[model samples]
Target: LNFQLLRVMEEWQQQLGEQHYVAMANDLLMNLDLPGQVSSLTDIGPELLVQLFEAICCDCRVGMIRPAVTQADLRHNLACVIDSLANDVLHVSLSHIRPADLMSGNYEAIRNLLEIFHGLMEFLVGRSAGGDGGDVTAETQLEENENLNGRLTDQLDRIAGQAAEINELAKRLAELRQADRPLPQTPLPATAAAAAVDAEAAPNGDTSDEGIVQ
Candidate 1:
């Protein structure tokens, strides 16, 4: 971390405050693909990246995004931010942020955030789907997201595997058909020996093998 980024982050921390991190996180989360999410308000510097992340999460937390916001709905949003940072945000290129890096950074904090989202999401899913189980509501979001994400992931894998199998079977069928069909047969021409024998045996034929000899 450079002094420039440090100063920028400090400024953001002061300006946005920790209470508003969720909203900040939310905005940054949505605008990963946009060019001027927060770099417009905050000065452009090395910590520019950190500033953006903080602005996103924190801004979304307490700022203007509340009415339509939910802490439990942020993984995909976070993933989107992470993807933008790793991929490039708003046409602003980032060196290379591995998704694993996001996973490892502040796992506890991230987990806590995810847990909040998970609970919130579960509530929404159940409420929307009309499922009932009062005790299951606490960590319902995490359980649901994990299960659904896993099932969808598995379904994709199965579909890919099936396509490969069908392709292989089609290739084999073509080969078997080529091998099973009978090959063309060429007829042998009549031999000279049979003609000679028939001439020799004729009642008026030349004696011995002289006639056939020529």
Candidate 2:
């Protein structure tokens, strides 16, 4: 198990970059009294196993290793890690592997545990990175949608105001046209028309009579 863990650490260092790996190792060493090298799987203790599990499963920094993995993939890989250790090394069925059982000072128990941890670390890294990116993207898209909706609402208001003004102008123009139209003339009575004709001819008839008398 120590040999497997060493290999896993070496591969992780290569993937994570030497500088970053060194920094992470320094931090882990500060918290725990772990040796610089692993002599045997029997030398590993429960504390180290717990620390390793926390580092790989719960630490945020592990995400830097892979950034594109999805949640489903992470879950699947974690399940496989547990199943592999349970079936091959422990020869038992396990829904989840406890840190205590990982390094109980027993060679068989510790065997392949670190290997499973290594695999689980890869998936954890992907999950962390992908979750952060997904959150940021979702927030950005939401903000953009809000901005677009605001713009659409403003345009609709402007169009509505313009339409209202057009309607009012049409109404006023109709009123003005109605005011300019000629009033209808009523027809005179037949008796009134005859009286008006005689009045107009009376002066002409009197002048003719005066001419004849002279």
TM-score of each: 0.24, 0.27
lDDT of 1 by residue, 138-214 (tens): 58756765665554345345434644654555555556455664322323324466666668677884555644544
* Candidate 2: residue 153 Cα off by (Å): 53
- Report per-prediction Cα RMSD to one decimal: 23.5, 34.7
Question: lDDT, candidate 1, residue 28?
Answer: 44
lDDT of 2 by residue, 1-214 (tens): 2333444544553344334334444444443444564444444555455456545545222222132165444434444445543454333444334433543444334433443454344444444565655445777656644554454345345434644654555565556456664322426755567766666667754643322212
Model 1: weakest 10-residue lDDT segment is 39-48
Candidate number of the best TM-score: 2
The alpha-carbon lDDT assigned to residue 8 of candidate 1 equals 55
> How many steric clashes does model 2 contain?
0
Candidate 1, RMSD to the unseen true structure: 23.5
TM-score of structure candidate 2 = 0.27
